[model samples]
Target: MLVPLTRQKFNQLIPLIATGPQYKYYWGKFPDFLQRLLISVVIAAVYVLVRLFAMPGFGPILFVLGVIGAFYWLWGPVFWASMRNAKCRRYKYSGFFRGRVLDWWITDELIGKQETVDNKGDLVIVENREKRINLEVGDETGFTAQLRAPLRVEHKVIARGQKVEMLVMSNRPDLSKIEEITDIYIPSRDLWVSDYPYLRRDYFPEVSRRLRDRPSERPRRRRPPEEQKGRRVEEWE
Candidate 1:
């Protein structure tokens, strides 16, 4: 299922920039207003220090840095999405390939420790562990790849021998080879498991269906010549 990068597809993907679990896991730790307040305080403190010391030409530099930081903090997700989308365009061609899960395993990774006051009024360190699932998948072409993603509840249903689909990029027009592969999309569960989100969920299904329904191409065998037909001629001595 070859899907070309188009303006329409790109537009469809824009809305999903900060909507995935990967983004939520990190940014959700703090409220957006609190994060904004922290950034503002940091910028104001830097400005105060620069002014108090009377640093020559540092005011303009601080202003420039503040603007850049503010822009990034506010629109970082969209900026990142645009950059990644641009990078993906270089692949030019991509196909949706179906593969079966050969094996899978779960691991608990320590993300960080947080300081908290337990009900006892004593400060305690709470460990934050993110459950991750590692999967091994292989397709008919004998191409196998491993994918790792945060183990959300929807992914708990994954088991060995389950069919999964992924979008593979290739320079070849026929998609004869795999250059890179995106995260796996589990149709049965309507779930996408990946460290990063790549495809437009709303559009991927329609493209996959169209490609699967299209006729496959195969070379026709050459027929024997009329003179050579119905005869077993001996090799020249």
Candidate 2:
């Protein structure tokens, strides 16, 4: 279910948007069939070894049970992963439906802070704010929306009765944890009006370019006021 939020509510949820690090999957570049084939081979060999060596005939001889487990992993979990990707493709690139938000809230968790050397080799401390939205769609549909960030939130204020669009995959109508929250709910995302970014916290420095460690060139005197870009700049050279 997609609920329409008012513009005000949308803006309020900005700061609470969550984000995290981006990890590259080892087989990300491989085609789906190749990746599945590789996984099947690896899983088969690993289970065969475990069944031969590790399994001690404690009670009722573990003959083919491990083999069954391996097959289940390949067919059940692995197959579902492929189907989930397909569903996402259909809903994201295909069409979507407009619905109203049933209810929503922000959830925050600490990912810890770390000190790192920047380009200048100076030690800098970085703190990450990780958050997510637990929203349920009702009053229109029964789908639920959840997202883990490196996520961008809607800058437009969302209020009750505001119309929101949700991506729909007719083949697999499950929307519990597959759809992108921002892409489906915020129409402006397709427009890029929100100045605030939805990106990985680790890569955030690239977006805003934060200066850390050994930065004393910026003058701290009382010389300010240059209308270069049509407006008086606060920190000027």
Candidate 3:
């Protein structure tokens, strides 16, 4: 069922959203505007020093520095403001529902069927039924990078009934603070249309095919004997 995300649920799942370490580091050290301003000032000073001593130039240097200072002053506050807005939006839209009425399950028997390799070139299987989604998260490089993660999933729509399709749209937790709604896919009516500008399906097909075709317990390819011996020697050395 489709429902609005409540504050209580937001508080509960906020930790599971897979926030990168950089978000925590920045969120903690500069929670206040004053600290951000001070840090910007320090950075601007360093830039000015480099310009004055290392790359002394014409009037353009000062002009560039001025523009940089302006950006520095606005960047931190703008970022925090966007973050606050995103949290509110996420609380407003987060929930559990299906993308369509096709009646799908995570395949309880094959949850957390990760493929790993051991030192002996043998495949190892670890069963974890507690995990919900089969997602591989990447490390965050910066604020822009962090925002891209949520944006990726912001374009998937949900359909509950025969003709009703609810578009799922929300705010990004970082920059690029645009409200985006995904395409609606109503399978019963055979209707599908995207409101978002860019809509492309590439990885979904390959992943779906793999999951549907093979058993989760399938073993991965083993490394050659020569490669295994080389790895062992390297480890010892």
User: Against the true structure, what is each candidate's TM-score?
Assistant: 0.62, 0.30, 0.23
Task: Please give the CA lDDT of all the candidate structures.
Answer: 0.64, 0.39, 0.36
**Which parts of model 3 are misplaced by more than 4 Å?**
1-31, 56-62, 80-237
lDDT of 3 by residue, 77-184 (tens): 445534643543453443211232432222233334777899999999877554121111111211110011112232243222233233233342211222433333
Ranking by lDDT: 1, 2, 3
Off by over 4 Å in 2: 1-87, 90-95, 111-127, 131-134, 139-141, 148-156, 170-182, 187-237
Better of 2 and 3 by lDDT: 2
- Which 10 successive residues of model 3 have the least lDDT summed? 141-150
| Top lDDT prediction, candidate number | 1
Give one digit per residue, the lDDT tens place, for model 2 in 128-232: 767655444433334444333332366335444444443333221222223343333433333221111322233323212222222434322212233222432
Q: Please say which candidate is ahead in TM-score: 2 or 3.
A: 2
Error of 3 at 117 (Å): 51
Error of 2 at 98 (Å): 1.6
Predicted structure 1: lDDT: 0.64
- lDDT over C-alpha atoms for residue 173 of model 2: 23
